[model samples]
Target: MDIMDIARRKERPAHRVFSAGFYGGSWDHDVRSVLGKAPRGGADVGEVLSTIAAVEPHDTEAWPTAWIALGDRVGAVAARAAERGHRVSAARAHLRAANYLAVAVNALAGRTDAEDRLQAVFRRHRAEWDGFTAQSGWDVRVLDLPYGDGTMPGLLFRPDAAGSPRPTLVMVNGSDGSISGLWCEGAEGALERGYNVLLFDGPGQQSMLLDQGVVFRPDWEAVLTPVVDVLLGRDDTDPAAVVAYGISQGGYWLPRALAFEHRFAAAAVDGGVVDVSRSWWAHIPDSLRKAYDKGEKEKFDRDMALGFKLPGGKAAERTWAFRARPYGTRGYAETLDAVSAYSLTDALCARIETPLFVAAPHNEEFFPGQSQELAAAVPGAEPVEFTAAEGADRHCQPLARELTEQRVFDWMDERLGR
Candidate 1:
């Protein structure tokens, strides 16, 4: 089934925690993300609310500054707690600080000094994340999984340090998701359920994009195959029970990879995505789309350039830059053209033999109804729906991590017979 065949939702009023127009829907969703983590000590409700209150909606500078300040403050608290030998308290605080710092890093996008600020804030986020994992007392092992010409950085977390084979869940992050965000998404829950969790920064993700300048590739099988190789080499990973779980944009990458690499016992995407370019296309005008279709790259670029000079065009241009940077493309037409390659065909979907689960959530802001389309195209794929009634809708059920984890991990457990 083609993604276009699925019906798209009309604009309708939905519940929101905040409605700051300048910051956009992504800002509100990011806020809910931290708050949702409070249950698992990834954040504090009071701290997140207080930080949000300090920022002025219209002041773009205020956004990153406030978050950086909050991150600094919490980071210091974590340091102090660690000094006092309060390991658990220190670990939780470190996670919160890391998450806040990541928020700041994200807010730096589109700024004149975005690259500098991103590098600075992202380093702090990475430090705090490292501190949390080291102090949390979990059985965590740092890994260097081999990739094309380099190695992808990863962390493997087990229930204990005792070397014993166990069911493992490999967690793949979405575009622009921080390592700390992965903890709230599924890593923490997986550990609690006696599942070994592996988290990594693949191409165009965090360290790879920022530090190594590695861009995203559509053939994600090239990424996951190496990950599987590393997992199978570990004495602590169960060869028969290794599974996969991905969220957000990973919804596309995981399925794309599984179509070629079939070693996973089971796999679940918080939502399924068939055509990743649809999200990019939604923002583009039909005129430009037509130009691109006709291979008129120069005309497409010229029209886009003119569009950015109109009222509110600067902001649009900034957004385009932020989204396009990871694609390793500078030209407007080139980036869209690159992203359009990230779609799955019926033949590719048919190649997937692994047990697949797809989440179809209400009000999926990006790639609406793509999950249904993906499930329909893949034979024997299971599709699960999350509704606002369950407080588990939107892109990744950001505000309902517990519910999302429960349903997803439960399916995984059943599939792995654990």
Candidate 2:
């Protein structure tokens, strides 16, 4: 059986998280055992981007991770692209790749260069978005509000006219999520089970990351209010009933947004995150510590030098490198520090008085302690913290459709009295 197959068949959360035993993400589990401090001189930029540029676009994982490492060391992979005569589009992509990496590496590590790289990526993409869009019908609209800059681009999906207003589920996508709004196994499963869905890139989400240079904010309510506003105005939407959900890193973003914009009648989440910085730092996994903490510059060199053999190796290596760096570490840390004062657990418990449903993998490797903390906060929240043995999938919902969608949405139906 394949690794995922074995993982699904087994009944352990640890098994689910370690299903990657078949993958190289473990850094062979030994390479990271080493420990030490970062070198003083830093990394080499030109060589890093040059190495990254050699990789293809579809290889999104590896490239970004390598870029993050390089950025942490030398910095300015974007500037390298510009210096190399990469076109405007390529330059922008390089920067976005860097942004993608920054996110992967977690917070900005309190570094200004990291923030600059991320902002540049977001800003450049926003400018490019001016003439390149394929949205149609009610799917694309201008949603303006009182926060930040007022007007923001948004896409809305309403229930088909064939039926009365249905329960609308607002999908608050997590960090740098896709702008295409294409449903993945993570969420498309929910749509099939009789739910009116509206997928949008709120502030600090993909749309903003790619344009507006607005990155994520501690106050996500600004985004949610306008979304609720637009939904209520739509004829096909049931203004009295709504459900909200966030995923991945979104566990934090979605709950915060719902806190102030408490229009949703219900809320849900998958593999959520709490204490973003700690979680981002911990994503490195216990296995990969040797090469990093032990200060094995040579092994580190191999990880970056080859830049292809690392985890997320086959995909956009440069982007993956970036994902491993500022985006994941630095940006994540910076934002975490900024929002450290706010508690998603507190936010949801106090503000989200509506019924809540939680779908979380008990043995989640990515973001641990978050679901438990959130579930613990609010009473009467249907906390289905499932283990792999008892019919739960990790990160995304890969369970029996009848369970994840039908049952979950059915609860929404019951709540809405539809």
Candidate 3:
């Protein structure tokens, strides 16, 4: 390619909040995600900015430590508020504390003591989340939805205790999102629109993975079917208006599930994903990919082990380990093969009869163009574009939650005749 060719292909930053690096760009997005929750009481802008100011750039340890400190302080304030009979203040503070601690949980990914720290911080975060749910002044039901001889943890939030049937919204989380994140993503907005909201931890999600040792599975229909069954059994749910929405990795799971489980009235994905493995394969070297493709698992594993020991490879190795854990595989080749099975085939897309909404955001960092591919493959599916001009570019529109939610729910309302 010539210089002019390269220049023509170059693009500008979507939203330049920070420079490029793990602690810079990635952390900036994470901070924006938390701040986006401020409108829904899941976060406090001042508290979030103050927490960011205390962290040192590129210091992995400092990232989690600072967030944890903020969470602890906020949690204490929440406890004091509750003691003083300020339920609304306590609920808001607890929600923010839960979100702050969730940030810490994500930062522990590449740490030496990640497993231990993850367990401790996750439990604390869940506690704060529970505290918020109890005091949020909503009619919330803590549920144990049946799934394959076990139960999936879930929360069903209703705007009131009128016991009348209402339109319902099932919110699915991404690979590593916290329960509080569901509120920021859709639950709070759904509630405001008078829709009953259901949030749960499927296999490989928060409670399922951390507490029950359940890992991710390619056939997500098995996971979502049980959720639909539970929703249908509730008298408070409008069977004709039960819809689903998913974000991030859920962009793949929900579509895959809709192919078989056709109970949903409508569905939406914040950035569609045609193949979950594409993101994983993007980081693997071509030589390693060749070995894996050739079924040389032993050779690939040996080469990967050596590569991890090279200078500057430790961080990458740690990131791989973190991402691979949900696949329930320790071997690099095995994890890659497992993730490869998550692709959506043309046949699968053709089987989906539900009305679907796909968010094709510009500058999608992970699954670029996959949203368009998914829309083309799925007959009658609507693909909406969220561009950089509206500050709603990038994977999932982390900083543009309100705009994303508005478009998605509006489409859903039109489809469900709400």
lDDT: which is higher, 1 or 2? 1
- Alpha-carbon local distance difference test for all models: 0.87, 0.49, 0.87
For candidate 3, give the lDDT.
0.87
**Tens-digit lDDT string for candidate 3 (141-251):** 888988788999988999999979999998888888888988888898989888999999998988898899999998889989989998899899999999999898899
Task: Mark the regions of model 3 whose C-alpha exceeds 4 Å error after superposition.
Answer: 1-25
- Model 1, 1-418: lDDT tens digits are 2232122111212333322111344676778777878878888989888887776444567878889999999999999999999999899999999999988887786565677878888899999999999899999888999999889999999999887999999998998789898998889899999999999999999899989999999899999999999899988989999999988899999999999999999999989999999998898899889999999999999999999999878767877787787889988888987998999999999999999999999988898999999999998999999988888887888778889888899999999888
Residue 23 CA displacement from its true place in model 2, Å: 1.8
Q: 268 in model 2: Cα distance from truth in Å?
A: 0.9
**What CA root-mean-square deviation does each model show from the true structure?**
5.6, 13.4, 4.5
Candidates arranged by lDDT, highest first: 1, 3, 2
Query: Better model by lDDT, 2 or 3?
Result: 3
